[model samples]
Target: MDRPAQISDSKLPPGNPWRAELRATASLAWPLILTNLTMSLIGATDVLMVGWLGAEELAASSLGFNLAMICAIFCMGLVTASAPMMASEIGRMAHSVRDLRRTFRQAMWAAFTVMIPFWIFLWNTEAVLLFMGQVPELAAKAAVYVRAYMWSILFFLFTLVARNFLSTLEKPIWSLIIGVAGVIGNAIFNYILIFGKLGFPALGLMGAGIGSVLTNMLMFGGMVLVLLFHPKFRRYQLFGRFWRPDWHRYAQLWRLGLPIAVTMGLEGGIFAGAVLLMGLIDTASVAAHAIALQIASLTFMVPMGLAQAATVRVGIGFGKRDPVWIQRAGWTSFVLGTGFMSVMALFIWMFPWQLAGLFMEGNTPQNMEVLQLAVSFLAIAALFQIFDGAQVVGAGMLRGLHDTKIPMIIAAFGYWVIGIGVGAGLAFWLDWRGLGIWIGLASGLGIVAVLMLSRWMMRERIGLLPAQSLSKR
Candidate 1:
């Protein structure tokens, strides 16, 4: 079986394998990086727009957003399992075009099945918030936001499926383009609805949620249209006639996706737990934590993007039976991701106060306190980005190798046992405050990164993986 040209020839030029590897990595990574940064900006825009409504509003919105994200992030992780599997299949060309189309239909159906019940549960968001012990007013507002956002779930799931399909097809730029457009639409809609601009009624927080929903729908619609009409996708039978669900492929997808969901859910749960514990301190402290979390999330996008690229590259490489190329793709992506994040970290460190001010206003005593604490946290957060990047990319590489269960366990141990355990003990028991919690997070991510990367390196050395052979399909 012949391997795809992209992976087999991805090696460095005669004298500079490292440089070639870096170039290859950058080729796949840059677009994703840009897309991530843009996505971050969208989040920043949301925060900024909503912050004008006042601190409680901002806090409530952030809390609601995080709650929704907890579920969405886990779902995204589950959907990502498709990327590696699809990439491997595409690289090897193992399945007929018909089979590929049927696989995608089944994947979409599977996603729909999972999301329907999830959305139903979300419809009673206030009750859930109450169970989670949120303030009454905050819970009410959150419920409204959740209900508005719930309408977008089907579209969001579709977008995820489409993005994964495009990514596996090695057309990530399309995903980026659609994301950018969605952000633009979100901003526009938010401006009009949140502030009642352009003759619209001011819906406040609900406006933001509605705007997001509309943007998602628009993006998904556009992607689907492009996929159907675009010559490239058409030539590839990207949306050929749909077929009945194949239980075998459906089960395979579920098996691969479930661990990913658990792994990411645990990670989200740990962070959410940190937020809960932070609330034990004071509203101001929780606000500061939220701000810092947002900042850290921005920095995380770089590595997240790199990890997505690594998943595609490595999955394709593995399918082609080229161990060396797989190793090259993984390492090159790791180095590039690390370096990219390191630069972002330096910027955050140098301009912590300025950056913090972006989320805090008026320089009042409480606001300034949150801002100062956020700056301090951002400093620690800068260092965490390196490990964060490494761990995510390592996981991506492993996903390419179709080795998800072990990585899922590693994430569980690192985040739950080590990260949350240490953070909770320090923050509550020892009274070390917010810093204590962050220290635990950093430690957990660092350990996970080293272990995962080491595992991938060892696997490559043993030749247990090979480049995907396109002819197999």
Candidate 2:
């Protein structure tokens, strides 16, 4: 909860900026890294819990959960618009309690406004899934999950807003604590509801969804309680006033947030689309794709966390009109992301079979095939890990600079045009199957990495537009 001092990089003694930047970056990044990883654990545990129910149930749960995530991701992106703006306000002027409060209020209204439609849409997606040509039985089961997860969307998006609020305020540890608590709560609830433990009726997938929904509410409540009670956040006076509609602030949030939403949708959708494409191959392919994707997603959380930190750091620097600190923060994040992914890639390369085996039965022929395909996919996943890390961290840096439009376009083109197109051609047109599809994903990520990095490299040409934007405050 410490108020971040402005322009500390300048006053520091010679040669100290490197260590200073590294320390600052790591301090902000590690808690977020753990938070994202722990958050991801909820999904992992759900998959593990549902695995006992059979492949159909597992696939249904995965499909339903992922579909919900597409909306959730977009909502989170919308909330993300507030974080950098908040951080910049802090760095630009030490006492920005009102600005912070206004952003938080607008964000709260925005969260509710957008998430309701997503929940409703999710509530009625069985027919949509069928229209997509998914298996009838599968679609029906997934719909049960869709209806269940819908209840969680509002709380989940609010939690994202709260997370951005706390983290950018230098109270990230609260969210980390709440996230861990949610995971623990989720596990206990899943055990009780998924298996009829502790006298609860066994509702199966329905139980899982209910458990998740309840956990989301609790997590959001945890954040609010912390903000209300915590000494450091008292100055903001966030909830004291009602958050009436403000079209100007709402427009500001939208213009910045919408492209981020689209960029993220394109990035996340390619992976989801890959899973569906795998579905076209067989149930085994779908299952294997899920397993491999789970592992990759887990590792990807590290860079994502770093990227978030970069956004905050870069935003602050931009607000302070110190492009030097901005560049330092940006490169520092990229290096950390790349270095961490290298280790993850090595680990995946060494243990693909072992990691893939954790998700399925080991003795059966069908499982063996799934394991092999999963291992193959993991290899491709490993190849792209660094690129994924670089691109995401790059995006985070640009976001910190408030450079959203071009990056969004770059991301969409790379993921959809290059990645999915290549994968689809190889999978369907060329008949290269799942492996080809994974390669396509890798190609897309690689292109995105190059484009984003190049953009950051040429940021001098992009100039001080981010800093200029802050003067309007």
Candidate 3:
């Protein structure tokens, strides 16, 4: 007779404790970290390359890109629902290899289905830019960039699905590799196309968009090729016969994904709305807000990577019915996130000018005024990073527990009802301008941090896990 497998308590170390957890977490986190950083670098490169074209081009492209990102952020959140589900399945070891393949295939179809409409909308984006109050010339330029970028959505979505699938399998390194390669490819393409190097036409701002599209396609192709031919993935029938669409599973994914989409959309919408609000103030204020936002974006990658790790760890613990491990994962991630942001905030506080100079050095008088405003805003922004980090990791823990909808609601209220409302009041009524706006943001994020952490704590105290799977019970 075959021997039965043994399962141990989640906290019962197999041999070593700290070393083991560190290894496990690092194994999952490093790739995610690299992926996040590379993704940031791609955005930074776009800004840098387009900045060369002219200030008007840079500003128009930035605004248009931010608008496009609001859409992409929502779509990304919907697709990210796949990560926790896949992680839980892997943790349970319940699915057959073929089943895993089918899951990924369905995810691709879902992503494609969602992206196509958005892509078509973006393809005809000139009207949208005009509607947003762009002048004809700037609107046309923005539309050209958006139109080029729209072509890459399908490919980018495919790569995202693949990356999420790997993350579920505790194989984030593959994502890191592909992300780095994509960044390199993007940089090379940007250099050639943006500057008319190597017989390429100098397309200016349009070239940055084209580079992004080309790199996305390459990344998608690379991921597909790797998954299809790699020996490890080959056993899973990754490229074998396509299964017919399973409506039940599809519905399940959509139900879980929709709230996530709304949550991300709300968050992105707040920032996009801020852009609109800033525009009403002055061009210098808009530029200042943009600089601070970009700086915050760079710092955000650290928490985001930790959050991804938290999702995987919590999913695994929940799958094993190990409440203690689940709690530990959440708290550990929170602590790590806090520590990382603390250090970053210190640096920003110490060298505000140095940091602002990255995007503002040697610019016009208007740009210099914007940089000064951004520097002043950094103090408030820095304080808020702690709360921002905490809330995101808390949300990730909730996602691991498959508790998404409530967090979505919390984010909606926190960002729209509280943050935006307060910021608008402060900016217009209080006449605090940028300072009032950031203060309002801090208040909203602080409330969200407390609420999310409280919810996680309550769930842990009750020894409750999500009801999505059998293992949670």
Candidate 4:
């Protein structure tokens, strides 16, 4: 619960701005990275526990979970609006307690407002899955899981908002601590509920879903307790007017958040869509694609955390009306993120077989096919890892400037038009199969990365900087 200095980056000593920015960004980023990793572990635990039930149950839960995540990840992105907004406030005024509280409140308001309709949609998961041509039995089982897991979204989104609140204030260690606790709790709950331990009835997928709900609730509850009692955070009084109306701020949150949500959805959807394309190739491709994608995603957590840090850092610079500071902060994160991914890409390139084998091992014909395909996919994934990191971190940099509308449009064109369109044409028409899909994905990410970077470079020219910052120049 250490308190960050009540000073902005614009006030940093001039002799070594890059080093200072790097240190600041790294310190803020590592806890957030560990926090993200821990959250991922929570999901991994659920998948692993449900997997033990049987292949059918595992597949059903995966369907239900992925569907829920589409909505959940979008909502999470929406609530993320609070981070940059709050960070800017902090930069504008060292002690922006009331402003930060207002943002947090509106973020929570926005989260609840957006999640209700999604809850209704989740309740009808079976019909949706059936409509999508999933097996009827699997769809039915998925529906059961969705019914129980949907309730977790609200708490999860709330926890995310709370995490942003802490991150903006540079006190994200609690988030990591709570997330680690949640990982352990989720595993234990899944074991008990899924296995009918301690007299609990074996509810199968239903139990796994319930375990998710309970874990999210506890996570959110832990965040609440920390905010209420922690000396560093209590001063903000984030919940002081929980029942009060702040329509202006609430609307503002939506304006800023909606595009971000759509941007994130487009990125997330393309990957989900890639899975569908893999399914068309064959079950083996789907399985192999899963392994490669999982490794890519796990490695991605590093850049993702750096991206979050960039948003805060650049947002602070934006608030101070210091374009120089903004550039320094953004590029520092960009280099760190891309540099980390380059190393990851090289490792994946050098050890694709070893990494793929971590998820699947055996020399049976089916296993070997999966292993070979996974290695192939990872090879392509390795090539694009840097671009993938660049695009995400680039998006983060722009988001800090509150420039999301155009990025949303770019994501649509890149992910859907170039990414999916090219992939579909190549996989089916060109007959390159899964490898074709991977190339298309790489193309999309590279295009988006270049576009995003161009925007950042031309930010001043394009009038993205604040009026005051431009005037100051």
Give me the candidate number with maximum TM-score: 2
Candidate 2 lDDT, tens digit per residue, 388-466?
9999999999998888899999988999999999999998898989999999999999999999999999887767345
In model 3, the number of clashes is: 0
TM-score, one value per model: 0.92, 0.96, 0.91, 0.94
RMSD for all candidates, in order, please. 3.3, 2.4, 3.4, 2.2
Q: Candidate 4, which ten residues in sequence have the lowest lDDT sum? A: 1-10
Report the Cα lDDT for residue 68, model 3: 82
RMSD of 2: 2.4
lDDT (CA) for every model shown? 0.77, 0.85, 0.77, 0.87
Candidate 3 residue-wise lDDT, 1-473, digit = tens? 00000122243376665455555666677788789888888888787677666656766676678778878888888877777777666666644465566667777778878887888778767887678665667668778788777667677778888888777666667788889999999999999988899998988877888899999999988898878887656667665666578677677778888888888888777877777677666656766777787888888888888888888888777766667567667777888887888888888888888887887665678677877988988888888888888888888888888888888989988988899999989999999997778877877888888888888988845445644433554
**Reference-based TM-score, model 3:** 0.91
Taking the candidates one at a time, how many backbone clashes does each contain? 21, 0, 0, 0
Query: Least lDDT summed over 10 consecutive residues: which range in candidate 1?
Result: 1-10
Candidate 1 or 4, higher lDDT? 4
Better of 2 and 4 by lDDT: 4
Instruction: Quote the positional error of residue 204 for candidate 1 in Å.
Output: 1.1
Query: Which consecutive 10 residues in model 3 have the weakest lDDT in total?
Result: 1-10
Off by over 4 Å in 4: 1-5, 8-11, 361-369, 471-473
Question: Which pairs clash (backbone N, Cα, C closer than 3 Å) in model 4?
Answer: none
Model 2 global lDDT (CA atoms, 0 to 1): 0.85
In model 1, how large is the Cα lDDT of residue 257? Answer: 86
